[model samples]
Target: MSEGAATAATVATAAGTAPLRERNGGQILVEQLRIQGVKRVFLVPGESYLPCIDALHDHQDAIQPIVCRQESGAGYMAEAHGKLTGEPGICFVTRGPGATNASIAVHTAYQDSTPMILFVGQVGNDFAEREAFQEIDYRRMFGQMAKWVAQIDRTERIPEFIARAFAVATSGRPGPVVLALPEDTLWGKASVPDMPRYQRARSAPAPAALDALQTLLAGARRPFLLVGGSGWTAAALRDLETFAERFDLPVGVAWRRLECFDNHHANYAGHVGWGMDDALRARIRDADLLIAVGTRMGEATTEGYTLVQSPLPRQTLVHVYPDAGELGRVFRAELPIAADVVSFAAAAAALRPAAEPAWRGLARAAHAGFLAHQQARPAPGPLNLDRAACVVRERLPRDACLTVGAGNYALFPHTYYRFQGPGTSLAPTVGSMGYGLPAAISAKLEYPQRTVVCYAGDGCFQMNLQELGVAMQYRLGIVLLVFNNGMWGTIRAHQEREFPGRTIALEFDNPDFAALVRAYRGHGEVVQSDAEFGPALERALAFAQEHSLPALIEMRYEADGIAPGQTLSGIRAAALAQRAPAAVP
Candidate 1:
């Protein structure tokens, strides 16, 4: 046959209707998500979700299914994807243990304000009253954390319910949405409606609030800006950068929101709390007006509920948030506006007045000082936390995404790396371990074009070590760098310093991480000596490219016996001083 004839025949075959009916419940649910622009779905398998899995396979071109090892890991990966793409991350899991395991990531998304959709399989109608295997009330259990939760009892309601769930999840106060798909209903048949596509809702800031913010900006002798969280869109970030530059105002990023601005920006003043330098902090304290956008300015970000030693007596705080409850929940605010972050920022930028010469000059000098301090900070030695960050930052592709687990190992990435894109880095601020590997694999699945790396410590990685097989099974090209300190470094630092010579149960005898990775049919290597670090990293990256599988690089470094901000001895001595009396002269 001629080439053209062969192409025509192939097109005819491919264009035919699906083998199954359009009324299939699982297919409808998947189609609803497709219409909403969701392209990836991460999951762990179980009997309850067999129907949903079948439907996902039926619509494979529209929604990609990423299988994971653990339910929590799947959720973490989905959260990371949502952060990166500004699209609702979809994840599927079975009921009971599966639902409970996935619940943690819901809280993670809620706290982070990440947009995600979780599809959980529930017991069949026949087993609901009999306590069927792996069955639990996910709706009630996840209600507190999710923006929306529903159990689909009928196949016909799948389209409407899921469309509503996405709207609620991605609208104001974006967070996780849970949808429970009953197994029997998924297998059952009904007419699937072609629901209207989901559209994100954005509201403009209130006129009164906009006028009030403008008035403050025009009248202030010293004004500051605090940017926080992932709610701000790229255009909003650009507007903020421009506004700060135009007015010469020093901007303070919320603690752990390094991705909000380039660390090298001239108008940047370091973080508001959590190891922020005293000098820059003092400068922020002196500001007469504070503009907070898209951030709760919560306890952790405020350094245990205090921005300064004492609240600025005359400072006017204008907080802008998507959630009404988060406003003025921590500190008193002169003006609290409930509006979409990006829209509000755009409006504020348009109305902002020109900066006075004197105030602009002061802010310029403050920004310069901040840059000097950043440069003056010492680098961690080879095999140290700083070196690991430096290597990855310099060598990794500019667009690569990273997943970092909670521990001392995470501190370096938080403090050292500068993120240029949204969702460039993923980590649980509430301090959850065992998230790094799974999140990395999830990122890779969501964005196959970019490199993905997960930074984890010995103790943290051990908690979810089984995920390595998931990486192999899917042929995920992720790089896993294990910081092998052989102890729960954060807690150990405290115990060693506070209780000198006292052995605590915080230490661990680590398995050979390299051997474990190799056992899973992936490349593995150890970097213990200074000279071997560069070579080992090169080999690992090469392995990732050659085999298109996960690569594990175990890096060993000497324990500095120090916490992130204080020495172990310093903490212990502080405790001792509080307990002991001064010597009598």
Candidate 2:
């Protein structure tokens, strides 16, 4: 798209006026963002950003600023937006403490390859050495975590730099970029030259590469594909499945992949990590050919980064990612292709490969074994996390979006729920709390038609429950299911298992979540016993559907010190023995 056409028509409107009126740099920044196709900007209100807030309010129609409860939640919400739409999500916060507050989500976005632009309002331009209130060198503070970190000290550079920030954020190796704008500069008057939007060029595989890939697929005794990240769209997923089926290849999703394919598909071998059965783990070791797309093969999926050392030596690993760095960064790859996921898959789909029925059969058997294992060890009573996850999965609308919070409790949905479409589930691979509520809000904001459900533990939910008001304010019909297990279940379990009788700050309590939800003018319901689980979910969904607002469902299960990291069911049963009944009012 031409630079002029890339930006919206407002620039043209501004230019046609013979009488030019200079506006605040902040307003110019908002206009530039709006022209660049930013539909929403998530933020936490702060004194330092008053000028930017005013400017945003002035241009509210062109760009919407979503007020979040916490700065971190705002960043997560932005990251989720970017995950949903293949665009750079925008998050604005104040300097120093505000930037620090949002650091976790920024790191989450960085690690997950979720494109986001975090604009932090800094101290006055002349106050750097003064150690003023909330003043800190943001570039230094956020340098390590962000892809690119810069401070905007001059008003004239706002438009061009910000436009570049968006481009860098959404480009290869997509990640969160930081822009620290000084408060004084934001209020300064400047005429920003019209900046246009930018779109990345799609990549295509070379004919030689395609030929090699096809030959490898045809000759391999056991070929497999691993899907990861939210880079693929539904159409791309379909094409991938078609290509896999044509070659009769097995498929396993990377750990916490957003959505790759239907788990019920006969050839699905299950996720690579997060406690898969021995059969699937063995399949990874034995597979002769492995083709990975849009995945980093991060530590979690690599069996705690042991793919190189332990039981699995490694196979012919082929990686395709938009980022060149991720190609061979993790597990060394036999063939690494740098290209956009959908385009690369499309290119691969055009190639022809010989069918391997034996490979297909092995894949089918592995899937069958995994399914049987799951069926035998069903989630049990006292509000079984696995069973509850299954129930939630059943209750979710077709193609519903799921957002998982941090903590062992989040493993409930991460392990149990199967996402059939791309971008259906969002969770921070970094495993940070306070991600769910904001992510849900962002999902709902982006895809209003789809049901967005957030799964959070009590400890995690408390980290950002205030976003409930943001949901209500936006009239976002998202459902929040809080796994209210009292204390920090994950840490407690660690204490119980590793250092028994040494629980310290992990033991803490909270206000009644249901009542708190009502106080925020949203619906709240408590599920005190196992019997109320199903009913509570139904009512929560109904309330969201009826009111067109967020609903909080606090399912009070016995924490029992069961940590999500425990791989065995026996561990969970043993953990349950340590519970003391605590009911939510």
Candidate 3:
């Protein structure tokens, strides 16, 4: 197991296949990744994972290792890769602190249903149970969040475990997996054969289920289609859209999954999440038959389960999901189909209504309502976010990719921007802040041709702002829009609604963000008013493209304007009016 050149051998695995190669565990793991066509890996280097880092050096041509600022940033980047490609995004971090820091992304991936694999460098076997330096039982730490969690115990078992990780990550409810690499096993050497690349498995609806769905649709006067979740192919999305069009069905993209369907289509209903219009909410609530595809109809999409009741929904629910466990986990469905999105969409597309849908006008009305909701509204500030968002929608290409972290500013993108379809947008369903920048970096690296825009609030942007250095080093031309309201905007709005003018620990002063980006050798600017926003954004976009660097625009608006058409003063006044007089108490 010396650092010398590895030797090749002809030993075969149980199944008998390729010739075995003698190399360290690190080399075997990395080779398996390369064989699986892994082109990129995100990592925050640590001594714990030095062996794997060295192995990555030899395979530089086949795999690109991106060194990020922090483990969380690396994890976020990896998670974004998973969302964009529908493959297991690879991330490497150290044990203990590193693994703990990256847990947020793991949680996000688990909830978002994105396929990702996080590899943590662990202490050697000899140090087991002795509380070695930076030692942690990742299985115990990540068991609840990750789909699967285990450690590599020996060099010879590397291929077996690696193969399983990929399969587990991409299976049924595609999710995150954690594999801890003990240092002793990683540095040890053995002659072992690599496992074959893993194949993804999917479930399809039964013929009877298809017939049942059509029968239900035939008897319904109003039917609505809801779509979201991971493992969606462009062709599958096309099929789903065709199914909706053929059925004249109003379709609501679930929660932050705005990219699940074309926003401009006539059958396109409004986004089914926070800030959704009343008409769209009514459509989801009042529809006689609710056909949910892919999405779980999580709390956010269901508005805390008021729109679609759980256990027993008011509407006739036809839930289509890949995992059988999720079929009846919550809401009771009239027809529960266990099928992947692609499979269900393909079959659903071929179905013809028994008669013309009774609600063609319903679909058209929903789309019209969605379009009308996008119009700009007056706010209390000179810097209106709706206007700025409209400018971005008009300027950027239709296929541009937009990423957003959590904050009140998220409403702007979720409400205003028109996502072309799947792969055109990235946002956390679990509401994780600090995701926009890292996700944008991953998107820019993956596509390179399309425009990538990241929208974040002041608080959200600062969470992993250090990752801006990674974008600069990689020369990714990404346009970042920071909505700087000089406070934790979302929290401040909540405080105003509940406590009404009694706010604390919410407001904070900010550094000159433009100056910070300029220090990284990237373009930066600030816009203080509506008139300045368009010009600043134009310059930032041009500079990023021309210089092959990141460009950041800081839009500083009135702190009074927490969200679109909602001001702190207005919220406070309304709260005060609703409260009983202090004298009565």
List, residue by residue over 1-585, the lDDT tens digit for candidate 1.
434435545665588833223456777777777787877788898788776777677777777777788898889888877777767788998888998988888898888888999989888877886777877887678888988888999877788898888788888888999988888888876644457888888877788887787777888888888888766667888878877877778887786666676556778777667667777777767778888788777666777766632233246888788878876666568888888778876876776565453476765777676655443233334555565566676787766777887787776666556566465767776678888887788777767777888899998898788888788988887889998877888887656556754757876788888999999888899887657867787888888877888889998876653333445556666766766877899
Model 2 whole-model lDDT (C-alpha atoms): 0.77
Runs off by more than 4 Å, candidate 3: 1-19, 581-585
Q: Candidate 3's residue-wise lDDT over 226-323, tens digit each?
A: 99998888899889888998889999999999989999888998789777888888888888999999999999999998899988999999999989
Where does candidate 1 stray beyond 4 Å?
Answer: 1-22, 308-314, 355-357, 373-382, 494-503, 561-566
- Predicted model with the maximum lDDT: 3
Candidate 3 yields a Cα-based lDDT of: 0.91
Name the best candidate (by TM-score).
Answer: 3
lDDT for 293 in candidate 1 is 81
TM values, all candidates: 0.89, 0.89, 0.97
Per-residue lDDT of 1-585 in model 2, one digit per residue for the tens? 323333434565777754334667688788888888988999888877777788887777778889888888888899888888878899988888889998888898888888899988888877887998888887788888989999888876788888888888877778889988888888877644668887665766777777777777767887778888656777887788887777766788887774767776776778777566677777777778878888777777877766432223378877788877766655667777888888887887776655445565766676677576543233434566666677887788768989988788776676667777766888787787888888898888888888889988888888888788898898988888888766777776666665555567876777888888888777888886657788888888888888888888888765552533343344544666556466689
lDDT (C-alpha) at residue 269 in model 1: 76
Clashes of 2: 0
Q: Which candidate, 1 or 3, has the higher TM-score? A: 3
